[model samples]
Target: MSYCGHPGLMPIEQALNAILTEVQPVTKIIEVALIHCLGKVVAQDIVSFVDVPPADNSAMDGYCLAIADLEKTVDGVLPVSQRIPAGAVPEPLTSGTAARIFTGAEIPEGADVVVMQENCSEHDGKVLLPPVLALRDNIRDQGQDILKGSVVVSKGQRLRPQELGLLASVGVGSVPVYKPLKVALLSTGDELIEPGEPARPSTIFNSNRYTLRGLLQALHFEIVDLGVVADTFEATEKALIKASNADCIISSGGVSVGEEDHVKVAIEKLGRLNLWKLAIKPGKPFAFGDVKGTPFLALPGNPVAAFATFLLLCRPYLLTKQGVGNITTPTFTLPANFSRKKAGMRQEYLRANAEVVDGKMMVNTYPNQSSGVLSSTCWGNGLVVAPIGQTIEHGQEVIFMSYSDLLY
Candidate 1:
């Protein structure tokens, strides 16, 4: 994956690699109950202390009998010596006799196989055995599912519902996980107004705040929202100082070269702007830097730009910082239902919908690809990555990234 665009602009892949290389995972680890471990990355490998199904057990509600005993029975009949239900221990199988065993019941010592109850009929004092039986049939061997001391879940793996169940299966009540990353969110623009406020001639409601907030929340990060800062160098500097207390800082707007864009200058005055600008459509003004010793990410003011840049760059960096091992968003190669006759210089991520048409999956891009059109994002389920200097034709194969893959 190489991208060709403006000489000074960084490629999206290079930008992501740089950000990941610079960020380090937090060292703090806390023990959390299994019920609360969802979306939390494990601090260490989770090893099983015991094997699942600690003992050989019956896999069916049937009769347990030693093969030799079954062979010795006359007229395929054996006396029932004992009954074993799930969780009940059984004595050694009486010779020439069978034990009535329920599913999950531990196999009695010296029992060689179990026959499903459907195969035999119960009488007044004996069970009629099947004419033939296979050794160990309908029996679950001990340790078949999981072995003792094996790693059930590796370090840095995020826990989902199934993971919680796995930990519980191994008798783990609590898990050690890295502390959630704390991020200070700042929206810088005087023209920005909070939602629910009266509309003004020149002010627009700040959608970036809610957009970034929702993204952060989806990743399970702690957010310190500083709200919208007045578009001034002083206000930006003050916010940066206050934001330094967090593990990382993410600010939207005030990153471009415009005179009112004071975040770039403020960051440089406090720390340093390591990287600026990216060769990506709708998000060329993205910036990466440090503010008062804390890592900072500056996004373009456009709501769509901020949303795309965060998923492409900031999300991975934040996940790395949170100790997650696999932060890559999955992409699929699908045929396009639309076409682009001309290619732009920068790589473009078009908001697109992917659906199955006549048994084939195809990508349908929204007609409008404007950075300021936030509605386009909601209208599409994923993104179609249009490479720099490349024109997409109808039915051409292209990389499609689903929002379901990126949101988390």
Candidate 2:
């Protein structure tokens, strides 16, 4: 295949959507306790088996009394029949009778309303009641929270803490969910040394692994670390073969148009490489293709470029491969706090911090923005996306994409 010939890079969103639209979900069904399914994406919708609050219950520590039994004690107190605490089913109520009940306790038969203890006075078996006694007050209606046979959550939705509780409440012990995507990560560069290892004067400590690993973990992808490989055909080729078994392969460095960059060559020898020079800052040399049918994503050598490409490109493709729905990214618009006049036809994502200034959300760019400077990425809460060829002035609105997204 032709490696290059003025292949214009698509916009970031268009590029991402193209990749994800072609992939499908990779998951199977598993029986697990609801407690373990939190933070997992649902493969199928959960239907409620039973109504929440199976029976009407007390929602407060109060007295359960028939509305007819309510009396304005002309001179003295009214009689109390019995007491019904939580978990106890009291005998049927008689005329002009009242039962005491606690929160979460099943309401006794023939009782329709519960008056808070503080709202009524009790002396001996006889009770002095308030003039007004309302029906269904402080009573939890059956199925109020959920209904039987109803879909609690749709398929492809991520389960959260509250979702787990809801599923457990409905007695769902197991759920169908998509399995995490399995990925193999490799870093290529002869001048790269692993963190904590002694490096020569010309070498820099490896950081791509940590950056890639963190993003993978956030996406809940199962990762296989291939470690660092020197820029040689033989060394890089071996790693590529090892990663061939993965659902996808990702590597940073060596994909650029440099003589020492051997990732592209290894990709060509192993399978294919579709290198695209993106018209964007910090992330330009991005290569995406395949290795023996397994998808491959080759990121630039700079740390920031690797991170940006992963977010702007690989993440969507990976999510597509995982069969995720609602794959569009979340974008928010806020006023620009600073002015930027540079004009380009490609979208620019600058590291920025957002804060509420005078009750309005505003974003400001970080001081230093170099592809190798990963610290700016770590410090940024979001990215300020300046439109192509648009000169943004202070107080003008700009689109912002937040890094607070838990999912990659």
Candidate 3:
């Protein structure tokens, strides 16, 4: 896409699809206990053998009785013939009886309706159901949620806490998931220094290393830290060789056109380097290729650019490698409280404070849109997306995405 004055830039969407097309999900799969599989992608479809609830059960604390008994009983009342707590089996409801059943208690034989306790009155050992009630009013039927032989979770689904609970509900104790990707992370530049170490002359602490580490850890990737490599073709080539065994080698910086930037050249010398200027505001210089058969993704040196590109582009690529098919992020349409002076040819993400104001979701832009302003990323809830050549007018409806979202 021709991005404004920058002529040879690729659209961000096109770049994302291209990167995804070149990568494949890890082939190794392992079976783990359901609890351990939280946040892990399911490698295959999981079919449930047992139905959720297994049998008809009470959905609330109430009285269970035959529907016919409810319509014809005197004062819609019946004697409490039994009390069935959750997990307890019960005898059949007698000709004129009601069983006291708590939530999750199996429905007794011959009982098809449950009257919530609030809808019934108890006096002299008899419970009176409301005059109006229906069959199975408060009963959760067997297989209502899941039937036997049904797929509980399809392949490529990331198992969350709720997913774990759902698997347990259907008697699934273990899950098959793809092995976590082994990622070798590195930072480049002679000016980059490690944290807790004294900085000599014109050096700064390596923040991207730790930041990327935390982000990748949250995504469950096994990280191999190659530390910071000095800005030299030999050093860069050596780092790539050291990390060649990793599934993906990720390095921040040294991929631009700067004469001192040697990572791109070193990668080309050892393997391949396809560099592209992405049509994005903060993130433009992006490199994606392979080194010794292992995929490599290089982000820009700017901190904010690295953050934005990792979340928008590299994060999705990692998820795809884990066999996740639906790796898109959530988004919403909201009003923008700020205005843009000029429209840029490339799509832009403005970090901003998103809050519910006057019963509407509104985002006010963070003043600093600089690539180095990591504070902007922290202050804003997510990105306010302005499409190509689209300038924002105050109160205009703009697309908002949470830091957690993958743009669709």
Question: How does each model score on TM-score?
Answer: 0.94, 0.92, 0.94
Judge candidate 3 at residue 89 and give its lDDT.
80
What is the clash count for each candidate, in the order shown?
0, 2, 1
Cα RMSD (Å) per model? 2.2, 2.8, 2.1
Give the per-residue lDDT of model 3 (tens digit) for 1-408: 354566899888888988998987899999999878867899999999998879999999999998787778767778999999998888888877888999999999999888888888888889878787676788898999999999999999988788899999988888889998999999999898888998799988888998889889888889999999988888899999999899998989988999999988888888887655888988898999999989999999899898889989889999999888788788888888889979988788888788988897788989989999988988978898889887789999988888755422
Candidate-wise lDDT, in order: 0.93, 0.80, 0.87
Cα lDDT tens digits for candidate 1, 167-225: 99989999999999999999999899999999999999999999999999988889999
**C-alpha lDDT (0 to 100) for residue 20 of candidate 1:** 84
**Model 3, runs deviating above 4 Å:** 1-5, 70-72, 199-201, 406-408
Worst 10 residues of 3 by lDDT: 399-408
Worst 10 residues of 2 by lDDT: 1-10
Q: Tell me, by TM-score, which candidate is best.
A: 3
The numbered model that scores best in lDDT is 1
Colliding pairs, model 2: 25-322, 25-323
Residue 405 of model 3: what lDDT? 55
